[model samples]
Target: MLEDQANDPAIVDQVLEKSGLSRDDLTSATYSAQKEALFVRFACDVLADATFAARAGLQFKSSSSLTAYISKYSRDLKQVLENASRFHGLIDPALMFSLRVAGNFAAIEAEWKDASYARYHRRTEFLLFAGLARLRDLTQSNFFPIEIRFQHEVGSSRNKYQRLAGFPVLFGAERVEIVLALSSLDLPVPTYDPKLREHLLEYGDRVIAEKRQPKQKLRAQVEGLITRSLPGAIIQSEDAAANLGLSARTFARRLKEEGTSYREIVEDLRCDLAQTFITNGMPLSEIAFSLGYADQPAFSTAFKRWTGQAPSAFRSRLDVSAKA
Candidate 1:
């Protein structure tokens, strides 16, 4: 999309050559985030066009695959945004879009989980424009937001942004946000489908779960193994290494290179899983056993270390919040 909108369309070809990347790499079904970011960076450097990313993004009338289908079947704009926020990790784990209602206004805030990625002007520009385009497409309306906020400065291109957005565009704000009237969230999607929307949401949840499993990352692989083994005996480093077809020494070395250790991985995983189990109303003893701890007291000590509170205390807090 960026390529098509480049000032000199041939610049994209030059960028591909300069970056040692073939068009096939981008068009591949398995195009990864790193590859996409590389292409964007190369294009941005070569083109030096600030508005092209936003222009290209504004042209994105539809979303990708399941996300698009899910949006198409959602009952209203509110449901569409909710589903988008819920299933966002499946599309791009680095960026998160959240919808919040405050008084008479609704704000769709875009937060970058990977802080480094947030610094990329091209990527951030594309995110905002693409989101606005998708929302307009879903509602079949050109209704504008009350205002748009961006964290990056476009310098002399600021006026062009306002003209393009058909609304006020504030730069160097706290974050990327699209502010709209609260009632606009209920704007019905023209193709709303209750039944298909339900089914698509279910499938989106499964996809999110599948994405959480191990992929190519060593850390993710180790975490996946740890999670699966949590209900039984603790998985030792040597055992995990063998399972991954690596020697214990090599496993420890690789994990260290990834900025973590096997012991840290297990501790972190258990800390997270402990809170989840406690929230689900699991008995303290059962939660301890599920996390492979020998006894509840040991688990409680570790939990306090991890979260600065006992499991019972955390559960009580959750219960109080729920009641309130």
Candidate 2:
């Protein structure tokens, strides 16, 4: 939700050192950037109890949106890391640093959604295995001890514990935790702002608490409407309100109380859809039409205003590269 540049080199260094890898292993790939950035953030936060960088890192330079970064790098990072265990023999500290960084990034997608406890657990497991594998490769020690705490009972997959995480897996615990060696925590990574970290934690707590309540139903309804109606269908406030069985005025008041507006929701939806359409190589005219635009010219004008490039030109560049 927070869109900022990523500039956390300490996090990068910490992951690499922890995994015993370095930067030379990543010279040929650009797709791993996002995963690398996020891995650094997550690893740093876990180890240092703060964000990877005190501020946004260098990866945030070209894109102001975190979602954009994720969209671009998620797959590439995964691909690069598919064969990570093969690099276990490298002894250079710097190379170890890079491998750790890559490993952290590779494990990120698994742990991305804290909202879903199951998803969070699954990701944590994957991250533990990946981290341990890297450690094993570096130290030549296959028997690493890892302690995992889960929010609910571990699911009934007999091999779930053994097949995924090679270490000890504990479930139905009071809190979620992954215990590795104390030395793993020794990687020198700076903490982000304490106040900001506290704020974020508090925010996460509130979100988790809210998810446990019945009021989340309303939020779900709102999200459903936003997802259902967007660029092509400019859903009017009154119309959307009517669909929800509320009077237009009442719906507007409720949205205001919730700290959002119908227009803002529409704009956000448009922005999300526009990015998807652009990435998928949809013609601007078609995209505009699909989004309920009047004509190609109108869509072209709006696309330029949104992204600083005409839709056709953007598509053309993509096409040229594809041919090349």
Candidate 3:
């Protein structure tokens, strides 16, 4: 991470405030280092732009890591949308940077699945409303027009939509998107500084290029292996590497070059699977079997270790908390 505290002070402040954490929370030497990963995950969860998170110095092992972070931090779909709204001002800039980065990254496909594409559209809607709200407060502009581009067929929480954004909402158009006039994008942020903006943009470009380099082949391979290993599929690191057309030693070497390891990737995938299953109310035994655990007891032990609670207890707590 860059040691220069002056590069993007506004962004740094925003990240700290949104995360409810301070710089010392990240840098305190006596703190358990493992907690840092959780903080990084929190940062990723609230930031609409992945590139912006990277520029803020949160290192991720894969795109799945980002998804997992969002899933864990967001208790429900509404919470996810709310956080997306809070970070709306940063989304446009972040998306612009992401587009540049995605163009350079060979592994990222140009097309998005319907579910994935809808997520971005919804996020953009939240952003537009939040941006307009900010502008309204700043300039007392009551005439700002807000338009959303998702169709009624695209299912979302209608109650929340009506409650949070009271604007002219349109659905089912030529595009699954939201549009804001350039005037909205150009609204002056009270904290904005030209030099800091330039620095962040440059830093974002650099980080994107670094992530796109061929040296991160192991990172890509691990992501592919995790994606391929569906429920009931047993995957070994050596086998995964072989499937990637590389020897185990070569894969390890490449991962080292990318500043991560096979074990880290495996652990990340397991955590992701566990969370998804828990959230979806899949049976513990079934989840264990799906992840290739030998038996229920073994799976329970692993779950306890991972989250400090039994699967049943976790589910019970989630249910109780949801009611509260």
Candidate topping lDDT: 1
Where does candidate 1 have its weakest 10-residue lDDT segment?
112-121
* lDDT by residue for model 1 (1-324), tens: 655555576877787766567778767656666456556655654444456667777888965678889989998888888888887767775578899899999999987654435435566777788888998999998778899898654544578788877789897588689898987898989998889988988888888877753345687777767754646587889999999999989999999999999999888878756764564356888778877888989999999999999888997876665465
lDDT minimum window of 10 residues, candidate 3: 106-115
TM-score of each: 0.63, 0.34, 0.39
- Show where candidate 3 strays beyond 4 Å: 1-217, 257-260
lDDT of 2: 0.44
Q: Please give the lDDT score at residue 58 for candidate 3.
A: 15
> lDDT tens digits, residues 203-264, model 2?
44454455432343333355456544533666677777888899978887888888887776
Q: Say which prediction, candidate 2 or candidate 3, comes out ahead on lDDT.
A: 3
- Model 1 residue 6 CA deviation in Å: 5.0
lDDT of 2 at 121: 25
Compared with the true structure, model 2 gives a TM-score of 0.34
lDDT of 1: 0.76
Would you list the rank order by lDDT, best first? 1, 3, 2
Residue pairs whose backbone atoms clash in candidate 3: 150-172, 151-172
